[model samples]
Each structure stands twice: as C-alpha cells, then as structure tokens.
Target: RPVCHTKPQPGNRESVGCLYSCAQCSLGGVLIAMDTAPWALDEKPEHEEVCEFRPYTCPCPGATCKWHGSLEAVMPHLMHAHKSITTLQGEDIVFLATDINLPGAVDWVMMQSCFSHHFMLVLEKQEKYEGHQQFFAVVLLIGTRKQAENFAYRLELNGNRRRLTWEATPRSIHDGVAAAILNSDCLVFDTSIAHLFADNGNLGINVTISMC
Candidate 1:
C-alpha cells in the first residue's frame, strides 16, 4: 500500500517526508516512511515481509511518561506538558537516583538539556541471569549519535563513603536498553549491594556531561 500523501493525520503536522507527526503517538509517532524516490510497484520485494502499519515508540524518561513516537511527537508534549521544566545551560548536574524500596522491576527517569542538546536518562531495574536483580542506568541522546559525536557523560552512585561510577558516550535514543546491556555500556549493579550506597531509598550521583 502506498503511504498516506493525502493529509497529515489529526493531531499531526505536515512534515517534509511521508512521515506523519502526531502528538498522541508514543515516542512521537511517525507514519510509515516511503522512499524519497518514487517507489515502483514492480520493484522487487525485499527478503522479508515489511509491516507498514506497525507502530514504534522511543523510550521516555521515567515510567509514567506518556510521550512516545517520532521527534515531532516529543516537541509538542514537551512544550505543553512540561512547562515547569526549565532548560538548563550548564555542564554539570547532580541527580538523586532513588527508588530503593520498590522491587520486582521499575525505572527512574529524568530529562536534562545542556549545550543545545536534550537527553533522557533512565535508571532501570531488572532481574537477569536466574532472577538476580540488577539496576542499569543509561543516557540516550534525543537525536542520532552523530548529532552528539563528541558528547560524553558519567554516571555515579555516591554514598556510604563509597562510589560506583561509569563513563561513556551517550547512545542515540534508537539504541534500546537490551543493546546497551549487551554492549556493557551501562552502569549496572546488584540490588543486593544497593544498600551500601542507598541512603533511605535515595542514592546521590554527580553527572558531568561535556561536549568536545
């Protein structure tokens, strides 16, 4: 089926490409994107079935975040919904990583903007390798990794006279959690050891993001 060229859907904007932009879309919903060049019906089918109607969502900061879909979707939601969030213009931030009490899987999320870039950081909880609890923290650059070519940040858990930290380049939002975990680019810790750093459910961290 041909992509929709008639009009942008309700709650959507007319973008340059065939991509439909809608606010209600999770992770900013982008309609099926057709090739920029004319696609011929006689073109050979690819090696696999392509589901044009399939929906996709990008991860947002925190579990309660309803924003998802394409970048377009995020803009409006950010503008209208998060009016109180001031866009900071600095290189360093201190984030309080909390939620030590709730178990069986959870996530704490926060959004930070610096150096003209937006980032979504998620500290996720999971059970891996035979039900052993693990906490993973990663930062995703809103745009492609290329957009943040020289961007870097460090994640740290500082408390109880001890500190655990990891530093790396922030991945693109397109990079899912599983891939980061598999690549070992995230900050991971055992839930059992969480007590060492967590002070009454909150863990403090110093985040320093730089653009070189």
Candidate 2:
C-alpha cells in the first residue's frame, strides 16, 4: 500500500492519523502506512507479494548482469543490455543452439512473446560432479506465478529416429531458471544424447507453449 497526504476536517478528531512512508521499492513510490488501529501493517503478509511496484531482477542468462529495477523498466533494460538474444513472436518455435558440443559451461537464451505475455527459453550446459556434462532446458514466464499457471510448455528433441520430450508448466520469472537447473527440475540429458540430436554442430529443440 502507498501513503498519500491527507488533511483532517474540522471536528473530526478520530480521522487524524500519522502517515509513514515505505522505501522498499526502487522506484521510490510512496507507501502510506497509516496509524489507524484497523490498518496494522505488521499483521499483514510480506509486501513484496502484493506490491505492484516491487523490484525485479534481470533474467539475463549469465551471472554478469547486475541490474535490477521496477517491473516496467525490465523490458527496456533487457532490450538494451541483451540485444543479441533472439526474439520470437509465436507460441511454438524452434530454438537452435549452435555448437552443442561446446566445452565447459554454456548458456543459450531467447525471448518468446505469445498469449499477450513474454517467456524466456533457456538452455544451459554444465559439467556435473564426477566430470560428466549435462544439459538443462527450461522455460520461464516473465510474470507472476499465478499468471504462469495458465500456461504449459514442452521441449522436444528429435533426431536419428529417437525423440526426447519434457512437458510441464512454465515457471515464473520470480523463481529464476537457475533454480530449476540446479534442482534438475527441467529437461535434462547427457552429452551423448545431445550429440544424437545434433546435426552439423547445431541442435534444434522445438518449444511449444499453450494455454492451460
């Protein structure tokens, strides 16, 4: 909630209350915490959940991004800072990752706009413990968790008469894609399988998102 300046009318002693401002949001929006008995701010849940002006971190692929700001400013920041990422307009598309056998940790990211919302498709390759490499692919909606629940996504890899598919609901950007990769809660496979799907050093994974 935000705080707005108010004045008490004559003979209205009970209407008087102290006003407190909240400085949690980066946009410097005024949060009015009234001193009224029925408006106990402490009794409420965390403001981050209900605050429309809450801060959002950049969902850019790597750990190099250090930018964070209001929700309205995220798209512009991404457009400026991550211009290389491909942007697609359809709900079903193919994400091609070149050099699928690239050594060491690598990540590929793309933005998809559909259903009047934006989603990010991420594919990450990393070396697991014991010196084996694995790939983690996930889709994240650039919106709230409740909004993400209305949609489902699927990732499919096909080649050599073999197909690997993983279907599930898209995760919200509030829950970073990295968490899913760390938890292995996405489409995961080893280098051997990835090679099977690769054609001339390029792996094209089909991604489809649909309303639930």
The candidate that achieves the highest TM-score relative to the unseen native structure: 2
Those runs of model 2 whose alpha carbons end farther than 4 Å from true positions after fitting are 1-54
lDDT of 1 by residue, 27-61 (tens): 24355544433233125222112222222244553
Q: Candidate 2's residue-wise lDDT over 29-54, tens digit each?
A: 53434444323334643344444455
What's each prediction's clash count? 10, 3
What candidate 1 gets wrong by more than 4 Å, as runs, is 1-56, 61-69, 78-89
lDDT, residue 183, candidate 1: 67
Cα lDDT over the full model 2:
0.80
Q: What is the C-alpha RMSD of each candidate to the true structure, in Å?
A: 10.7, 9.1
Model-by-model lDDT, in order?
0.63, 0.80
Worst 10 residues of 1 by lDDT: 45-54
What lDDT does candidate 1 reach at residue 43?
Answer: 55
Locate the minimum summed-lDDT window of 10 residues in model 2: 32-41
